[model samples]
Target: MLKVLFAGTPDVAVPSLRTLAADTGHFEVVAVLTRPDAPTGRGRKLMPSPVKQAALELGIPVIESDPSEESFVSCLKATGAEAAAVVAYGKILKEHVLDALPLGWYNLHFSLLPDWRGAAPVQRAIWAGDSVTGATVFRITKGMDCGPILAQSTVTIGAHETAGELLERLADDGSHLLAASLEAMAEGRIVPVEQPQGAFEVARKITVEDAHLRFDVPVFAVNRQARACTPNPGAWCELHADGDANGEPTTLHVLAARPIADDDRDNFATMLANRAGNGDADGTSASSLNPGELLVTKRKVWVGTVTDPLELEQVKPQGKKAMKAADWARGARLAPTAYVK
Candidate 1:
């Protein structure tokens, strides 16, 4: 059995921990190092990490620390770890920490190397509109996600799939891949391929500003933004009134939508809604409304984007709780040609 130290945080890392723990005799996970407790939910009580919870159940020593490179090195030295496995560890690792491990350290990243390198690769890949993405297990190096790959597996990014959904699939697949990769390393059957050099894209962490939608751009770009931001800081845009007419202010959420073929527009301004597409009971209707215009049907609220109008399935007003867009429109002051921000 190999002596190992596992460092990780969040649900993404839990699957790896489970595999290592369950395979008792084959591997001895000496200790689990995770981020210190964080406040969660409405009451703001501090909570233990997923890794910590699993480690406790298995009777493994658990170390909770702030995810700093220095702190990680200190923890490793205490354990005299022969090897280390990291998954979504959150903290950036330093050269000394990587060097200290007797057999060295490895990371299981959510995307293929040199493509979406850095924190939040999966989300960034979708945001960039890439159709294909995968998981990679590589030797941890000084640079961010710049390491020699030990093994990898790919998966398709469906058009309407959410980031959360993609992550769930990847996590389940990657855990087994990690076990096999580690198994190979133990038997000296796997070879580490050095990463290729060149101009590769890096995944910048998503921020609040990234969520703002630009209606002036094409609907395809809008669609890309929406797909990229699914199940999190979602892609959003304003549904302004058509030519400053009667009504109060309102906005809509493009919860679920698809791009119509002929709605392409070099100029987002000229794009108009024609007799409506599919918006359903959540404030969408079949009506000949201009682009960026809004229609209230059956007391529901729908808005036309730079492309065709989308059915606003979910919506929320400024300083209000999120709810069905139609319900919100009905309660708030809303009417035809209502401007949204």
Candidate 2:
């Protein structure tokens, strides 16, 4: 068995830590490294990371500080760990610590490297509408996610899968891959392969502006944005027309949506304008409604876009509980062709 240092943060890192810890015959986890505890939740109480909590339960020593802490590197040097493994550890390892591990450090990234190679890879892949994405175990380098690949396992992205759901699956898959790679390394059968430079695309960290829903794009694009930003920063848009009783436009966050199919592109706009009164003297002008318009009927709620209309199934209004899209539309008393903005 080989002694190895394990470093990671968040719930996503817990499985990898637990796996390496439990497989005592193959590898001994000498010490666990994680970020310091910070305030969490509405009560704002200090809380240990999921990795720290798991390490304590499993009887492992936890180092909850950075590598630059006074004498921390010296203490780590005494662990006699031959190698290290990091998963979503939230910090880059310094050169001294990297050099300390004789067998080198391994990172289990959520995306197939040389493609999405930075923070939030899985979310960015889904956001870009990539049909396939997977896990990659690579040698840790000074550059961000720019490392030699050791092992990889690919999985298809579901059509409408949200980032939260896809991340859970990838975390489990990556854990197994990391454990197996460590086993191979212990047996001296693993060889790292250099990632192709030309195939690189960065996955930049998501921001508040990235979560703002844009109605000018295709319906599928809008749907992907909602899924990519769901349960995190959250994809939202402001209402431009319909106001509350106090005459203020409400901000709405889209939680779930589906694109409506229209076979006749030529007649689609005309048909929609007819179905919903087209905001004219006779209520039938095709030019009355514009893209981003909100069309409300008794049973369904559809929002216009550049391509086809999108049916909003679920939405969360500011300062209120999440409700069905139809319910929200019914209460808005929408004009013949009210723009959602």
Candidate 3:
């Protein structure tokens, strides 16, 4: 069995750990390293990561630490590990950590390297509207995710999958890559390929300001942005009243959505307004309000935009439980030209 050390935190790391432990007789994970328990949620309770929970369940010891080289490397070396694997560890591996292992450390990154190389990968790919994404096992060089590739596997993004859904799927993609790579390593046959240098783009971390949506932007663009932030730093749109009345804008969380339907789509093919046609069934008014603004609301919610309208199938309106947009319309306190900013 290979004497291995594992370092990672978050749900992203859970899959690899589970895979290794499930097959423990082949690849023995000697120790697990993760970030310290952190203050989470509004209550600020100290919470363990999914990785920590899983490791403890399996009777594995976990070391929580900061990004400092000595702090990370010393704990790692104590495991006397032959190889190390990292996934979403939230720390940069310094040169000493890489050299400390007999076999260099490897990282399982969410995106195809040389592409989405920074903080968020699955979200970035979907936000950018790329139809393809994959997992990359690479040699952990001293830079960012700019390491050479050891193995990779690609998967398709469905037409209406949110970022959270995609990441859940890619967790399996990452599992397949890691297991195959480790098996090859056990047989002394795996080879590392260098990452191509140049023209790399940074996947900036999502900030609170990133949640704000501008209605003036194209419909498709805004749609992509919303779903990318789903289930986390959620993509949010604000509503301003047609008349005076409000304390804080109406916050809408985009959950489930699809492109405009055929009937509405045909209407949008020319001009995406007035399709619902003068108060269809619900109290919502219909007219070509400016794109990025609400157009109709009867059984469903439709937001008009420059290219096409978006049908919000599922969402959570401000201060309300998550419910179908259609259901919310019956009692919604909104009026015509209520805009989503």
- C-alpha local distance difference test of each model: 0.71, 0.82, 0.77
Query: Model 3 off-target regions past 4 Å?
Result: 67-72, 242-248, 266-289
Worst 10 residues of 2 by lDDT: 279-288
Best by TM-score: 3
- Displacement of residue 79 (Cα, Å) in model 3 is 1.1
Once model 1 is optimally superposed onto the true structure by TM-score, how far is the C-alpha of residue 239 displaced, in angstroms?
A: 7.1
lDDT tens string, model 2, 268-295? Answer: 4555655655632354332333567876
lDDT of 1 by residue, 1-341 (tens): 77788888888898998898787766788899888888998899999888888888888898776545456677678886788888887877667767888778888899988788877788888877889999999999887888899999999998767677898889889988887787788678899999999978888887756876554555556666766676667666655444354434344455554454333321222222222333233343222344555556553444545645444567655556777776766776544546554
lDDT of 3 at 293: 69
Q: Put down candidate 3 lDDT per residue, 232-332, tens digits, no spaces.
A: 78777776645334645677777777657766644443333245454233443223445666654466677766655677787788888898977866667
Pairs in clash, predicted candidate 3? 213-341
Off by over 4 Å in 2: 241-248, 261-289, 331-338
C-alpha TM-scores of all predictions: 0.81, 0.87, 0.89
Candidate 1 yields a Cα-based lDDT of 0.71
